[model samples]
Target: MAPSNRPIRIAGCSGSASDRRHAMAMLAANCAHDPIDVIIGDWMSEGNMTGRAALKAEAMPAYEPTFLKSLEPALLDIAKHKIKVAVNAGASDTQLLHSVVVKMVRSKNLHLSVAWISGDEVLPAILDAKARKESPFENICTGEVLEEWKFEPLYAQAYLGGLGIAAAFARGADIVICGRVSDASPVIGAAYWWHRWQRSDLDFLANAFVAGHLIECSSYVCGGNFTGFKALESKGWEDIGYPIAEISASGAVVITKNKGSGGEVSVHTCTSQLLYEIQGPWYFNSDVTAILDDVHFEQLSVNRVALRGVRSGLPPLTTKVGITAKGGYQAEMHWFLTGLDILPKARMLQSQILTLLAPHRSRFTKLTFTLNGTAAENATDQPAATVDFRVFAQAPCEEDLSPKRFFRPCFDVIMQGYPGATPHLDYRLGMPKAFYEYYVTLLPQAAVEHRLHSGDGRSLKVDPPRETRVWPRQQPSCAVTENGVRLGGFGRTVKGPLGWVVHARSGDKGSDANVGFWVRFRDEWDWLRTLLSVEAVKGLLGEEYNGKDIDRFELPKANAVHFLLHDHLDRGVSSTSSYDFLGKNVAEFLRSRHVDLPIKLLNRGKI
Candidate 1:
């Protein structure tokens, strides 16, 4: 079939490991709606990758089991409709996943072609680089060199691009399974294959890149975890729809969701997902470097938004490789302190526990004491006024951090503990479990030996596209003016939550956190822009801000300001001791912060 000017519609099925049920729901929804030409599934996460690596070491299957389980119900429909599937559910074992899929298809007597892409695994290459005395693998966020690591890594995998998957489809493969490709690469590959886009088509590639980023998280772009969830309540967020992208030959895109699915797809929702994990204006992927500063979004109608102005250049020489190592064993416990003097009660309990463990302090690699929530004054319910004191400790091995050794001390102090204190009844939290430490560093893309296997004794090698131009490193800059602007003309001002006039979203990138906020009206953009600077963000973060490096960028077309706070999530989601490990609620916390708003803007009801 010749390439046509009509836009290609592609639907995203799963976002991560926990999205299996929703993913199956989306498959049915996709078949009922304007049928999708391609379906993309992103099921791998940083934590999931580490778990899969551990499984592989034990000589077990390392692929995501949910991938086949969820697809089985819709496999017949997908085959009958000829809807191509490209997914990264292969995790650490693409070859095994390929075999399993082929067997399943044969059992069903389906004449579909299956392909698998490999070579993202770079453990041997990393060992070779180390032996050759190549440059040290410094941690991308913390700058800690690899030589300082105390334990050997369990596995290392580089983030691959979409060219391999695109080539698989070019060879007439109906299903493509990939190991460790970037989450958005499946969408990128599908768009490239469907559009027949050339390697040097940077503009088209950038457009597709932005489109993929917006919908890579499935229900996120459909208002699932939005900060302005109160406003979306009328849209029925319980059964939120999965996102879909309609891409034209020119590379322009319209983002929407399944027709009868719940959730709103407005410009606000799109902007929220755009700022999820980005570091700067330049978003680097293996295929291209997308310049996101000028990307614009416009609401065309209900549940439809048009995207434009995305530009791209050649990607950087390096790709990121995630190295997971057995960090140690960790155990945590919580105690509730109720009513008055909660802080003192928590402190007293902590002091007693530390005193009891003082003899064995040397065994611990790290220990933390955290207090969550504050006792409310004049609260009626007992549980409502309680504060949670959490104790988290890590050691070199499970023997040093076992539940029996840790829990006995807490139990011993309970009889003599402070007033109104009670230990949380969850026994599982005290159990020792191994923790995985993640190290992210860069590797040259040229070193990756990517290849596509057609599953029937046929394979082909793939190479990175030739670079057409040099891409510069993005610098930190803000739209803030040196002199403070005047807000006098707006008449009276009211002190209220920033959510009254702006929508915000925040998420984690390893240990760092990114928050983006925007206003609805163009007139409010200038005031909102001027009010929120890097310094303003620091103030909003309060004590959590500390003195870490922060980067700021302005997306004028989207009327938004974005900030990246380095080392803010306290070592990321998997091993973090923070109450909010994923940083999902950071944006909501900032939105709840009180701010001075213009009376006129509030009177106009523009928010």
Candidate 2:
């Protein structure tokens, strides 16, 4: 296929702070190779945003320090290559980030224009709306009205789109810093600018949206945090390359990685990421609603996959707003139990701790005891056979959650507690720290006034395209199972892990968890759909399934089934006390659950 007029090549350099070193490495690698039109970084995550909000509350700069630090190493190369940089690393303060970037450019004697996209912050708007009783502000996840919130919010920011970014680029910005724009907005903006696409070009925008989503996490499409990690390890995981998207004028996207870089980019890897964190087939972004129900991927060659069949339409009237507030202080302690009767030992420890805290029980708002892991049979090492018992306590004030008052009980019963009781070496685990609760809801997009400010003392207001038509929200259809595999008719069945027949990717969306499961063959789609119904999913979750609402959607083109489990994360990642706060491991845990597999499909040897 002939390329379309200088197809825009955008490289994603960063995922989050955890991948900062690798992100910088990717940037350096990109600098050494052919110049990419845009190098994007995603530094704003739920955890990072909450922390940055707290910092802003404390009168500290809202911009992320690590973002500047990571970019410094490759700044010269970036300028020399004239690679336009875009990042959401501004966190809560894009103005400060803009100034810092400008100073850095001047210090290096480099001529580069820096711009920032603002208007994501809507705390004042929210306050006004609430005071005026404009509308009943309800939490999108919990449906609880804002008036019922226990704590006043410290920060509220709506998720912006790519219009402001595109405007900045049009205004000759060499680097664009943004706060709380969707992670994929940078790539979307770059593609829109390069293609000269209008706001109504939903198809092209949808393609870029999917492409941006794939590479937004940087190494995710390059095999990092992949379900098929064993296969990626063989291809060298340590030096995994970051993802790059080659977008055609028509919106077709080719996902590839840096040449000679480690890790592989195949259909499976791209598919794994495509399914991450999505609510349903209709991916609602502020810019466009990407219809991924028909989206499919094809491997073009080694380390290259072509994304196709995606469609798009006008987005919803409202954009998501994330509000962060102080939820009080939390403290936790861990105890290790080993050998036989692990449950009994954990129970005994919990009982003793509770008995010791009986006098001070009234001070705590909530107390929890979680037992993690089980003893492994024939384990060679003692650590391998140990189970962890965790006690978490939350209170309205730090004094009530102080280590001397709350964590003292755990240490006091060390000698008299259950046999083989041991605690982790980290003493700071007993210290109380403020917890930030996240409340996500929707706000009218028209209410947000997105503006792009250029270094040349010029500002432009960017607005969403005028609505040509309004379409009713699409509801998830029932699971399709007409051609589903019938186990009884397939001779014999064997009980095994579901992973033998399906590939799954799971992630968090506020307090909810979304898990997408797909099959390699189209013939297995019905079987997958039938085998993983809502009831089946609940069963797969076993003890963790808390009888919450579960919505399922089917994607025929991808031969996949997606599920959204509401209120599954216990109140989002920041306040969640669960081990898998982000729900990153939910799919893997489900895959491990034993299920009845058809003998015929197992014998096919394609799984």
Candidate 3:
């Protein structure tokens, strides 16, 4: 497997652990029309990894089983085309998944060589830190020392680099399985191996890094979740095409999808993906640090977008490590309030709930009672005149939230209650379920045992980057400066949803939340940059921002404003009693907030 000057074409089939079921089949079926070298999927995340690890002790299949399901339908076509496959889907049990995949291939009489990359499971490293009198590392989101965590630790995994995956491919492995590598490591490894890239190929590696990030979420770059979803209506959404990246030896990339696929690839679609789940202009990776400030996208054709101008720098010595702990148990109850006096009814119901739980309130870790909006005024339909009263409670002990102590008492309220005290028809909502909290922190690459195990019993150790650069606690220079906000400058105004003039995408990073907003026009970008100052954004977030720190950055080329809200999701996904569990709807919520829109921009109509 020698290096070639030919461009390496890689495609993505899965975004998350629960991504579409036919993605692999769709991509593999179109291989005859648009041949690709490798098909990759990014299925590892804080929640997925911790959730899978929690099931290991129960003798459950802990690794991501959905990857096998996705790959099964396309196996024959993939085998016929000789396309390589790589994915970080072997969450916590790579060995088990590797054996399962090998057995599948053997049962089908396929000649694919399967290799697995392990050593990312770093619970031992954390235990050693605790054993040697060393203080636990500070949490990545809040900077609080891990010593403050009271729960018993469950699992820890250090994010691995792509070199091991590259080593596997170099050894002629057709399919590579990984445990907890970074989300983009599969694409990075495929490109690195295809071009015979070296450790010092910073700029080249950076291109692959950005390329991986672009397509790492599969159809996300093909209008799957684009704000311009109306455009996708005509383009077809049911089977939106997955993304493919064509990388030249010099590391330039062109993003495209299969011909006549049920999706459109444009600059806006790519830009939306570029702005998603990213903190600042400088996106870091284990192989190289990519400077996205100058990175730009150009719509080359109907379904092809060219990406370029990605500058690079030395790799970081550390990568993100996720630690999972048994937080406790959580339960939720949904009660609906219909028609008039919604506020008084909500207050009465809440008062009754609090009174009922007062005896065991001390056992509760957190209780979130939300009266989720009022019904429409004199509404036409019965459903429109109904609102949800939700109760989410978490406790360290199961008895605190048991049916008798919790649900039964609350259920008793209906008899002595507010006019229409309707609980969700399903009584199971109040049943306490075990939950795990995930803490993210930086781990030194040297502490990891990154290795590749190929067929024929050969093992290869992939070393860390030769040179590393240290980043400051805050990189203010990496972000663009915001001018003063002048509430009125564009024209005569009208109050409306921000979504009318802007498009947004948001997601979570551990307990922190990341949101990005962009406009369809350059004039709107001017107004957006000045209007969305850090203070303005904090104000827009309203209660969600409640004194939390925020990091704001601008991507001039992408015409977007990005904000990182620290510790906004409480204790990450598992323990947080939040409406937006993973903060995926933060941007949508902000977009729904009313704001003064200039008539001139309003004339352009909603995006």
Candidate 4:
């Protein structure tokens, strides 16, 4: 029987900051009162994933598995209440993860709907997609080829928003489990399913889109990191409040937190989250036609905002896609050497570290120096150079050693360098200011033509079949299933062998690949690995991807896979400046992953 709206409650929990146990306990309490229709769990971050992969490669246990193992018990509790759930918990390991959740739900005799959003691995997707001549992606980081993208992906999240959630709900799955869905998508799915709204209902869709954005970052509204923390006091700090959206039929949202929890809900708090990563002027949603405008933040009550004036718009047939390619490994290190004239003191501090690093330069990839601290006025016209109060240092893996090793000098500085330097008085008490170094890469995205098809119905390895074929310039026929669509592409007829070059970008220097695959639809995500493992392209690229699950993939000459996602462009474009445009909301609903600082990074990287 289809679920008729009796005020269907959908709750999502992010596992980035808290453990799965905490999410489970909160779910247990919330479901006791209002048995929720859907529960979403998020637990992946690119930064965290990179670090974990590094740790795993080093054979050290830096990754936390509490969230990974806590799924069963939590689902069991939801099953006890006959509650359905969907979780973006395991990230790209959807197929292997699906069996686990399916078994758990069936064990309790509860129905379940599970899907994994695929195609975010820039490297694999590009090569595979290009080889199949399916929907292809391009590289963005380097104007050059990202061949390293052939490594197993570090992350593979396709950002399935309302569509996947609605599909899961339509299937009568008591629980919908996902690997990486946009935070607000589950709520949006529930609202769309309940209202039976058309894709063109821009106003209503916009309202629902606003609701998802407002409450997507649960803790933000509930006081996890509200800007005005000093103003509010929480009696039950032990248990924080989760967010809820009292969505009206017209799409207007009454954003609220759970009953009896610590946190203040005010216009300021809601506005802060809304504006957290707002970059572009417009904000978009999954429904394709929904666009937010004239977001009026009214403090109707404590922890409540009466949002109004959400507008919708027509959606393009295709959605906007994002393609991330292999940028080099970039890292930054920060050291807090607080003392008098910290600027000069830090300069000397930096020189000392550089002196040691210069000798072992080959170990490093790149090196950069910056000094930040409040300094007096120097009104010269040529730039008026006045250093910031704090000394800042940035080094890339290409120039300097690893970020970890680069920052190790801070310990040596505290122990001996600072003591021997002129600023004996500059030395503060406590440890030598443990300098923390940050590392990242600058990847690029390009555009490429592609196709979509059905799998050969031969194997189930959760990857693309390792098949090798020269995708033709002409469009190829494809097969679509109730589950999802398959993709194929053509490769250049290189002289060396029957193999093809999988280029991460369409440009002459783009990464080349011998194979590629573009798996569309959420249900078929489980078969992505097997699909990549096809016989034709087999032995062309290995299964074990690198740091990210969605490794470097090929893209069109100009844009990344995002160029192909133009179908739903209007959905991502925000209409009014008042509305908060956050990448996390967009990513959850659109890409299945919560992109931290996506709007900022996207703009900075110009993706």
lDDT, candidate 1, 57-143, per-residue tens: 678899998888877777787787778888899999889999999999999999889999998999888878877879588777777
- The runs of at least 3 residues in candidate 1 whose Cα sits more than 4 Å from the true structure, single-residue gaps closed, are 1-4, 20-33, 468-474, 479-484, 604-607
lDDT of 4 by residue, 1-607 (tens): 2456454555656535254356655665567674555565556543343444344334555333555465666665765676655555544444445556666667877544444333323335444654675533333222222343343333222344565555455545555444434455667777777666655566766677667766666666665554345446544555567776777666767767766767766665665455433211244433443332245467798778776555555432232233322223333444443334555666777777776666555554335555544444554431243332222232333334343355455335655544224322332321112111111122111221111111211221122212212222212112222242333222122222111111111100011111122222223233332222222122222331212112222111111121111111111211111111112222222221121221212222211
Clashes of 4: 147
Per-prediction TM-score, please?
0.96, 0.96, 0.97, 0.57
Q: Looking at candidate 4, what is the lDDT of residue 462?
A: 24
- After TM-score superposition, what is the CA distance of residue 333 in candidate 1 from its true location, in Å? 0.7
Sort by TM-score, best first. Answer: 3, 2, 1, 4
Q: Model 2: runs farther than 4 Å from truth?
A: 1-4, 22-32, 468-474, 477-483, 603-607
lDDT tens per residue, model 2, 94-135: 898899989998998988889998999999888889899986
RMSD per candidate (Å) reads 2.0, 2.3, 1.7, 18.5
**Comparison by lDDT, 3 against 4, better one:** 3
lDDT of every model, 2 decimals = 0.82, 0.84, 0.85, 0.42
TM-score comparison, 2 vs 4, better candidate: 2
Best by TM-score: 3
The residue-level lDDT of candidate 4 at 366 comes to 39
